[model samples]
Target: MTGLAGIVAAETRLSMVDGENGRLIYQGYLAKDLALNYSFEEVAYLLLYGKLPSKTELHGFQCKLAENRHLPAYLIRILNELPEDMEVMSVLRTAISSLGRSEFGWKPNIDQAIRLIAITPVIVAYRYRQQHNLPIIKPSDNLNHTANYLYMLTGEVPKDVHIRALTVYMILTMEHGMNASTFAARVVTSTHSDLASAIVGAIGAMKGPLHGGAPTEVIQLLDEIGSLENAELYIRGKLERGELLMGFGHRVYKTTDPRAEALRSITSELIGEDAWLDLAYHVEKTAIQLLDEFKPGRRLYTNVEFYAAAVLKAVEMPAELFTPTFTVSRTVGWTAHVIEQADNNKIFRPQSEYVGEIPS
Candidate 1:
């Protein structure tokens, strides 16, 4: 199949993407359910360990994560040595690969998974700071993952609204059925590669604009629109020009993405009665109307990136950090799938169709 669309590569017990019905399920629970009830650490535990953690289990898990949050001095030195213009994803990939603390024979273990999830935010924040010539703030052992991410991003304690909005976004994005990056992670892991190598490859795949990089573009789209009054005209003009609206469509979901719905609600709650939220909603309404009018019968509803832009903006996250933050949240999902793949080892060797003229 072209782009391997609709091909079931592997059976997973982790998460399901019901594209037709617009639902995302993680371990038999609706994604929204988990987002509302679970903390990022708790969600990480569920995905990595296959069940929600008990109170004590959760405490221990949190401590373990906290313990692993700090990067080694050598890695920090390497972060300091990165070129000022180096992309965040490249920095993250290099740092994660540098985190290969063991030999290639290392199996997929919870310790490896926890270490990956824990260090991702630190790497992102540290690299971002160094790129901008800001001092690297150490990770906090006291705050939870979401809070700590924001805290490190800005060297101050995060506001509750920022914490909650980002937490929900993290939960919703934690896992879904084999997206490009997750597939990349699983594919690397299938070869019995070390967890860090698999994760590094996944980070590389996620840096692509077609995959994890769209959220930042969504922000650029809105900033270009500038005002609600310009939204309809700007959108209609783009549609008439056959331009791709950055956040309007999805490859899998025919209906409104549940993650987008969750993010819209979360943004509303976090930035109540704000100009940004008002503009985003106006843009959404206008764009949906224009799309329905311009492209008939092809229902292009709002996907996660649409409101993910708003939510990240609401939390004052820089545009460049959009995909890296995604990498941070998705590390759990990647490692979980990696562990699962390792448990049931199978080398992913798909045959490609020879398109060009082959020598007979």
Candidate 2:
């Protein structure tokens, strides 16, 4: 009976997502502050090693991350052959599954982790180009994770703020305790599966509308509303039908999501001068007011999806690539968690209540 939902053990190393206070903290530091003040390399070091890296350690880590940025030709060919009409997430899933078939597929060593981190941006960039019939841009050794991803995707270096926003988004989405995708990863790792398989499983879970698919829907809702004047009508109509606003609530966060605000300010900074900034701000204000006036006691504040979509939209990344880009950044966390689970190896079976009658 005690094993029904097997304890994943007293929470080991991780930042707390403080729902009530609207804060996300890594080793006790706030996420919004981290995104503003730290580089992605620094944040990645903190997540993987449980402490901030020294200057030399960070440089070395960044080098290793950059080293794996080059994808094998075979992988790129496979990606190019995928149907252009396929959804980008589908393409990512297929590509990772393909990697699972490679020689180093199931290895859990440092090499495997580096490879996953390095090539994720490549898969994302190549698929994006293939979808658009544009030439694939290669990764550069000089650039860090955030910079390289932007370069490969757009064939140019991003503005400092844009890069910083993306780096924050990556860190924010990196790891959360037992999120659907993270849980899926644990289940796969329980089988001593390869990194690619574990990632594929996580991607499958994230494909669900309740999880990774919300950002795309959030963007769609904004476009449908078209202007600030219609924000109230749009959100009210959706809520009246008993529909949950796409980016407003979380299953775990009882009060607010801290990552939302972190990304919210980033969205504003990135959208500087685009008229859409004003439109989105008005929408945010209207959404808050309506949620307060209507839902009264509910603490449905913005989650990461709200500003994530806005920020990415401001960067001109297509709506379809939101989740795929999410996958790329989050792959680091998935790999880190899988390694952690395998190091303390345990099967992740959970039993459900037997509600049905016994068979004769």
Candidate 3:
């Protein structure tokens, strides 16, 4: 028998990633179903509590998220000092890693979750503004997490479609169990590292091409193709050279990524009549056709990356901010997973098959 990589954990109820079939289920519900009906707050509660929250519970959750929107003064000062040209993710990585030093002897459970949640958007927005020489914009307590992030990123109140598109992105990107970043979180937690350390480690992992950063590349692919007329040729040429298409493949989904469908719809609706929508549609169709003709043996289908890039672009978000925006939406899931892991009290230690030279 061949040694197993254990890339697919068959037993854990942690997360379900069905790449061949293109399905992603968190807890028990389908990601597409959640994205269509639930707000970001509702999905966050569902992920954390194992079921959808009732109306009253959801209201309370929204309030809690809104209440925690402000960043601490110290973090603000640190944000101000960061170099203007630094990448947003780099700034976030450093700021979050340093947050551990500020933890006082003790704080209440809710307080800690609140602290993590509140400061996330601030950190994201602060770095973005600093990069452009714009002043930091505080999140409005009256808005939900998704809404407030848009408000902070772009000073105007986003329309309903914009909010919905972003909310769907959040629901889709949230916890995928034992993914590279989640495993990083669990690994750091296993070492008894602080929450901030675990999160910083996770952020670093997510910054990689094979992980959370793929959407930015997907957008770049679209830009290079430039128009629908060029998409098929461009993608086919790349596929011929054995280049990995950024948005089409997944490690776990054997069929189709459900989140892709949800995001595709949101992008279409958000753009309505924009030229990019037609371009994206043509690209999607062309990619499918080319893949069918060229890579018949492989199950490469569009994943969350495709529509995530489209929707972000539709909202006029710069390509550089894509992953940081991902972090803004996913912080809820990260915090929820961290809390869940802390509750279960397991040190995520796994045995490794030794392949290196063994000492006598």
Candidate 4:
């Protein structure tokens, strides 16, 4: 039972991670398809409500999300008071924890889920702008979820290309099968805890490097390689030295990550628009070839974090905001799991084996 590696903890109607086959499904739709064709709000609605929303329903949902995007004055004041030296993730965890008031208590519902999902990006943007001494941008009623997030961060209406790229990233990452953060959310919800409390726990788990830090590392790897010409040499040197290529493999996917494939397809269409993405496409090709030559039978391929780094960088997202952006997308999944866990509640109490023996 170490790390519960093979244990099936709980049943969920959310996204399915088919690592053996390199597919991800949300409710019933292919996550790749959803990312390629749907809006962030649409896919998020699907995860939270168990189906895609009709036009009217989507409009209402969009308005509800937009309406809730503003932070309370008290939360803003609290964000201002936090130390500048604190990690953004720590600030995010603390800001989210502060929302665990009476209204967010047991039996979490869609309204609460919507509120949490809508406000997470705002919280991150607020803290980010505050740290940089930039004026906080209010959420735009006209823009969709993904667009508004970029707008809030940059104080400009993002280009359609950037929005499309980031929307695909967000939709694809909105959920996966039970990972660390989702498990933490469910574990808290099993106690009939508030949604905010569960989300706070989830954010704490996501702050861990093993869980949410890959995209930043991938960015670093891309930066070091710097160009298509260096791709082969940089990657070959790393492999020759027995260093792990940050974005080329995944623990879950034995084959190519479907999310990565989908992102590659989208970024390919906009190839010359962003150099980082163009370089990523080249680098991935070179790395796969090098990986096969250097580590025979390893079956290493690009994971989602590979192109996630490219997309975020193309949109001018700072490296520090990488995991926090991931958090914003994953909040949809966390709240959905919280609601599901509340429906069929079970307090998690796994037994730990004791290896130490009494002195004889």
Candidate 5:
């Protein structure tokens, strides 16, 4: 059936994607409330461990993540050997495979999950630096996950605003029902596979443009529009010409994505009237108004990708690193799903309907 649309193939208590209501719930806390109140680490702990942590447990969890952030020398060498032209997602997947193989485990565990989540930023940082000829930076035990990732990328202590903003993004995106990558992860885990194999397969799924790669195209669209004056005509022209706007719609949310609403506040706080931010806001309004006029009854509201572009650009994140950065947060959800699947232990075996004429 059309990409398994409307089919409930599995069960979960991790996160809920309430598409009709345009709400995302991570373990009973509303996604927007989590973004506004909780740190990424707390939310990650909530997703995996099934509840928020105590102060001491939070400290211990932070220490575990900080302790694992440094990659082995050979992994760094792998980053160096990767060609500049190679897709970063492939390198990331293979590097994860290498990391997984180095550690021998057949079943899912918290340690495996922690290491995968912690080390992903390091992998992304080293490779991104190597490609740009920037100096590689080490992880700091002093910093939290978001700050540490920014420091590793920029080789400077990150600003508080950037860390806070990205922490919201991480929390909002950490888990959301059975997304493609999460499904891929659970499917692999159901076969009694290694943790790395499952994560590797998940990464391969996320690399597709229809899934994780949409935000970079949002960057391109915003750039092409360029100014507030250009927004209405530019958007209306694209609508009239039957071209799709990258950030205006989603397969899930029937109204404004809650994550988008959360990020709009972050973007406003960080951008503070920048020209591109202004233009993006205007484009959003004009696109919404025009979509109602042109295609009636289509919900077509602003989804997370729209404000994700704005928030990332406000933090000075390069367009190319967008999806890879997504991996850093999303790994938490994938690992949690793997553990859940391993606990339940069912091999996914869906039957395909045969339509071709059989030779009898």
Candidate 6:
């Protein structure tokens, strides 16, 4: 099944990507609705625990996440010894693999999942701060998962709007149906390997540019456009020259991307508050109009990375951290898939077709 397109490899109760209708469902709830109304911890809990947590359950989960946010001394030392110029994703892959002790062995469990989810942002922020020679900011108990990540990166409490925007992005991106990284994670788990090992594999897959690097390109597009005045001209020139627009369309989403829809709503609400988001909202409208005019039957619309570039930029996230941030959110999805794979284990062994003649 060349690249496995149109093949149903396994069953999952996690997320369903309805490309036909441009809808995403997370365990029967619309992902857009969840992103608009729920917290990151709530959605992560939903994915990992198979349901939303009660008030007491949520407090306990939040406490557990806060407790596990600190990096081990050995891991910190490892981070210090690594080269400053190493890619952040490479650093993350190394740090996660370092956690594969005997306790993270076969038969993955929720405790192991929680630990990885909690510490991923710390690993990224630690390495990033060290690379820039900035002081490392420890995680704050007062902040929730989304806000703490922002705090660690900048050492200041983030604005409520920035936190809300980032939380929506995180929840919307937390899961999708069998994406490359998620598939990599599940394949490794199917080998009866530890959850950490499976996640390491997923991180490796995400490290590839094809999967996790779209946001960087989208950022470049936004930077080039620069302001609302230039959006139409810049986008029209690209379309006229038959150049690829970075965030206009998607392979699976035939219409608008639901994730993009939710993010656009948030960005639109903050129109006068953030220049980048305002620019993004305008640029998206211009680009879509130009897309329909230039490539009339293509039906190209803004994908998640379009507004992702805007939101992250509005919150002052550096360009280099884009994919790593994606990794941080996607860890929840990866761990959830790992747990599901363990429940009904099967090694992923697909047959490859050969065109050459066989020996008789």
Tell me, by TM-score, which candidate is best. 6
Per-structure clash totals for the candidates? 0, 0, 15, 0, 0, 0
Cand. 5 TM to true fold: 0.92
Please give the TM-score that candidate 3 achieves against the real structure.
0.86
Give per-residue CA lDDT, model 4, range 229-331, as digits (tens): 9888888899999999998888899999999999999999998887878998999989889999998898899999889999999999998899999999999
| Better structure of 1 and 2 per lDDT | 1
| lDDT, candidate 2, at 124 | 84
lDDT of each: 0.87, 0.77, 0.74, 0.91, 0.86, 0.93
Q: Of models 1 and 5, which has the larger TM-score?
A: 5
C-alpha RMSD for every candidate: 2.4, 3.4, 3.3, 1.7, 2.3, 1.6
Q: For residues 295-353, could you state the per-residue lDDT of candidate 2 as single tens digits?
A: 99888788777778777876777777787888887787777788778778878666678
Judging by TM-score, tell me the better candidate of 2 and 5. 5
Task: Give, for candidate 1, the lowest lDDT window spanning 10 residues.
Answer: 265-274
* Model 5: lDDT of residue 142: 97
Error of 3 at 175 (Å): 1.6
What is candidate 6's CA lDDT for residue 39? Answer: 96
Q: Can you write out model 3's per-residue Cα lDDT over 1-360, one digit (the tens) per residue? A: 343346542234435767656677877888888888888878777776778889998888777777766766887788778777778888889888667875711221444555666677778877787788776677897878788888888887887777887788878887665667777776676566677877788889888866776477788888899987788789989989999787887666777778888887766664545677567777887998899899897877887778788778867777777888877766666666666666656566557778889889
What would the TM-scores of all predictions be? 0.91, 0.86, 0.86, 0.95, 0.92, 0.96
- Order the candidate numbers by TM-score, best to worst: 6, 4, 5, 1, 2, 3
Query: Looking at model 3, which ten-residue stretch has the lowest summed lDDT?
Result: 104-113
Q: Which stretches of candidate 5 lie over 4 Å from their true place?
A: 102-104, 236-243, 271-275, 293-297, 355-357
Model 5, residue 9: distance off in Å is 1.7
**lDDT per residue, candidate 1, 172-206, as tens digits?**
98898788999999999988789998998899889
